[model samples]
Target: MSSARPDIVVAIDGPSGSGKSSTSRGVASRLGLRYLDTGAQFRAVTHWMLSHDVDLADPDAIAARAAEPQLQSGTDPLQPTITVDGEDVSVAIRGEAVTAAVSPVSAVPEVRARLLDLQRRIIGDGGIVVEGRDIGSVVAPDADVKVYLTADAAARAARRAAEEGGSDLAATQASLASRDQIDSGRATAPLVLADGAVHLDSTYLSLDEVIDKIVSLVP
Candidate 1:
């Protein structure tokens, strides 16, 4: 057994549908480390905003209510949970409405600050595999290991469409492109490959292959 305290953190950054979440969770489970989905946290907040009819275009309004909900995230790899304002929001956060508004909500500086503080606290506690757009670039810049995953846009959109079960290919492509633009262009914590981060293009790799590569990098 490794004598280390297991406090080592792995930061996985990628655009949407790049398979970072699945790979991070699997790697965490295999290595007996905790898993954190930063995207889910953003989605949880977005879910709250939508439920409360907050104007997503207004940064002040989003930031004002940043702490309105108590968001809890489950670290278990097999089953993750996200609760907003004491309500289980694992499913609700993924709705089309929330998905459509999440980019705008997440782009707000205040919302990012609120969530970034929480994310740092989560990592400070112990070992974790954190997956998000700016985890390596912003939240956990000193992470023990950083990986940037990507794939061709078409491949990424196709994979996402398949997961969504019969999604429109053209629409999915457009949505993915739009999200990429927003996530990469946002002022705060914009998505970018961190300095010295291991780059993995997952377009042709199998899930197990990707997981194996990541596991090999863990100390």
Candidate 2:
């Protein structure tokens, strides 16, 4: 495995279940760099909103309270952590309710602004692998290595279902489809393949293969 230069930054972006998290963490761990799951940070904020009874259907309501949650993300690839207001919510953010509502919450401009500040602070001075829907296009456009990872719809659904431990494949597929539509259509920081990013289709690749490919791309 190749060791990362201290000033290197890897920005990996893709739709949900496209192996952004796994691939990023693997690359970061193998290359001796920190990792940030930006999706999990968004999920953490969504979990907080839901817990506070924020109206999911009202974007204004969500924006009004966007900065209420104090989110802290642990950058260690091996044992990343996410906390909201000093409470650990690393696992709770992955639950069904948060998953269902994360799109709308993330779409709020206020919410994006809030998290953008946090994300940039965490990504300071590089030497980190940041994964999310917009890291390449928006968060870290000047990153040393940028990757837009993707896979076929059915393959993505199956991978997500397996990760969630027996989620119905069809249902998972529909859910991912819904998120992709929302994420791609959102006005602020919508998902897109960044210019100069290596477009990697991982439909036929193993996790290790994916990680190795990204690792080799670092300058």
- Candidate 1 structure quality by residue, lDDT tens digits, 77-96: 77888898789999887778
Q: Which ten residues in a row have the lowest lDDT in candidate 2?
A: 1-10
* Root-mean-square deviation of candidate 1: 1.6
Instruction: Tell me which residue pairs clash in candidate 1.
Output: none
lDDT to native, each model:
0.89, 0.94
TM-score: model 2 vs. ground truth: 0.98
Clashing pairs in 2: none
Overlapping backbone residue pairs in candidate 2 total: 0
In model 2, what lDDT does residue 90 have?
89
- lDDT string for model 2 (55-172, tens) is 9899999999998999999999999999999999988998999999999999999999999999999999989999998998999999999999999999999999998998999999
